[model samples]
Target: MKPQTRFNRRDFLQTATAATAAGVFIGTSSASHAQDSPNERPVFATIGLRNQGWTITDKSTKFADFAAFADVDANVLGMINEKLEKKTGKKAEGYKDYREVLDRKDIDAVMIAAPDHWHTKISVEAMLAGKDVYCEKPLTLTIDEGKLIEKIVKQTGRVFQVGTMQRTENQHRFLKAIALIREGRIGEIRKVTCGINGATGSPVIPAIDPPEGLDWDMWLGPAPKVPYRAGTEMRRGYGGGVPLHTNCHYAWRNWYETSGGQMNDWGAHHVDIATWALDASETGPNKVTPVSYSLPVEYKDGYPTVSDQYNSPTKFEIHVNMPGDIPMIITSEGDNGILFEGTKGRFFVNRGRLAGKPIEDLETNPLPEDAVEKVYGGAVSENHTANFIEGMRSREQPISDVWTHNRMLETCHLANIAIRLGRELNWDPTKREIIGDDEANSFLSRESRKGYEINM
Candidate 1:
């Protein structure tokens, strides 16, 4: 179902003013009550308290207390514990396994920032256990996982928000460009170019014994086991480790196994904006065709040994055939921004800037009233996290709800699959299968270690 319509701008402003006055009165009366109410603050736990997990905790501090923390690595958990105590002035309980935290009934929600492979398992379990979840972007590791997460969210009726914060930032130039596209300021969007530049290669290092205070097996999780090597340091780079890990952490955008290479990483951001702007959230392109690609032919030091260490495509192009006459070309160039080719004029937008030949036209010709409403849909808040919190309270679908996100994810995943297969593959979105290609279908889901099957 589409989102419910509430009020127009004029009515929204009046209601907001009245609500502010009422909230002041309620705040005055509830000050004493809040002191006595133990549940006033929502209790939350964070799994995978590494890089992005810390930021999520910081953002949610006002809405909840960091009641517990979980991570497979002892070193990382210790640092998080110290930081949580310092920020909240209250010590939070810590656990090595995320499952232990999920078992707690008091924790109302969980912020999952685990690696790409662990997103679906942890999120599915968290929802089944009656906890709201905020999972990181590219929602799942594979197409099947995305479908499974969507199904479980619908079944449980829990608030599930994907961390696509671009939807939240009101001043984000890229989204504004999208609003302009939908407004017809750029006319009909005929094609789009999205750039995600490189691939991930294996780290060249000798195998070594696992470190003290680290559970190597748990860290591997559902992924196939490989011996500990200097390369393993690249996996957990948030602990102020050596430069090798830094490259891996920040450069995770390159890898195929851990990430969707640039296609899913940056594509999730830019391509999602294109889909949203085009008003195609419910359905996506029927076809994904890989036009061309370039991969390293040797491996350099810790880079792809074949030619470069990165196995994912360094350069590639894919075409998505949306319904009607709208078609988009998602490519890996033009300095990491979205370029929209329209009938009127072509425009480009990235983080801070939006530029084109007729850029001034956007200033004089505002987006139509109806189109702006459709884009924002009468929502007063633009903050992504706040939207999730509101959805948790109202039992409404969030701005980046799991259902729409899964659709975007399917497109991103398909690009990766097509590139890996080295051939164009037809997709049956309804069936969630690659037509007539058994080998391609097999890659839809990976083999989980004996204990990690997702029953749903």
Candidate 2:
């Protein structure tokens, strides 16, 4: 079949009622970027200032100028603003709301490292405002959001990159691994395992007042309102805080209302690479079955019965039957890495190292040293952030484009759904539906809180 080279906004709108935003967007596209002179850099704003957000922004300074910053927590916002001002030598304007930063015409791009629930909304708005986007992993909080973002990308023709940085870093370890798989070194992959580890469980903590300078209401945004409950971690860790509202920072990944537990947390990274290796970036599993799962709280129809405690599944194992009858297993039972078993050999890789018979054989049989370079489109030197900034200037799609990432994210979302439903699901990837299962189909999109409905 021919690949989808174009998208009809009207056709998409008609079929994707659940994914549509509250209203139409009529903003004009930003003017085409002028040819740049040496020493000039694209101006950008960052919408989140916590852990991953700060890390990405720090790396991004190499390619773009920090023009603005925004965060729901005013204290965090001020802290980053002060740091950037001192580090960059230019005072960056900070805002408590992301919309204020998006409204700035001078800002040509945005780095959206907000919570999963906020990623689609902020990214869509930024693109509509004529800004390129760099969003953190697990691009969408739900399947429908993936489709929504795909439509907006086509409509805007803006450069967008998902923060699956494993594709770009680590001396091209992942790139080499992918090339080896595609080169038939692993024969024909029969089975693959993605060990993304497990989720965390915590006792229900009591609620209290929010911290000073934090806009707790705005922080909750579209998610249902719950009392503030602070965490007990140290000041340096993600959950450290006096008991108040829900934990922010890295701790948010463990809640179903805000994120997708380890299924998306690490699934966004390992499952993504597995999909790329399988050459299934544009397609996915036709069957998803939940082999086992353990949630911290009871759930009914995919909604948590209790609001307190970390509600995402703490332990789970899922099996996805992909196109070509390949079995992909996602589990928390092993080390955090991907293990591929093929007819010829098997290999395992994580952030720290890549190893196995196939990799060892390469030392003797020698894949042309240029093998890894070719997998990266011959640009082995650029890190992920540099690739996005350069793509912006060249009008090319970044290494981790939204289309492929969304397809991979869809696979992750499907696994989560199967676990939540406690059954097998037959999927129609092309139609983006769950076959013969109305209940599972309903899980594709979620109802956004009023006033927070994403406007496509």
lDDT of 2 at 363: 72
Please provide the root mean square deviation of candidate 2 (C-alpha atoms, Å).
5.1
List the candidate 1 regions with Cα displacement exceeding 4 Å.
Answer: 1-39, 199-203, 231-254, 296-310, 357-359, 368-373, 380-382
Error of 1 at 227 (Å): 1.6
The models' CA-based lDDT, in order, is 0.69, 0.80
Worst 10 residues of 1 by lDDT: 25-34
TM match of model 2 to true structure: 0.91
TM-score each candidate. 0.83, 0.91
| Candidate 2, 1-456: lDDT as tens digits | 112212343233333332223333223356324213324688888998877778898888878888899998887888788778777887688898888887787888899988998999999988888788999998998898888888787666677889999989976778888889868898999999999898668877656677788787777787778777765544444534433225555667778778898999899999988988887877888998899999888888877887778888889889999879999999998899999999999999989999999999987887877677667766564788888877676555678888778888888899989888888999898898899999988888877788887655
Q: Tens digits of per-residue lDDT for model 1 on 76-132? A: 789888888888898678899898887887777788987777889999888877777
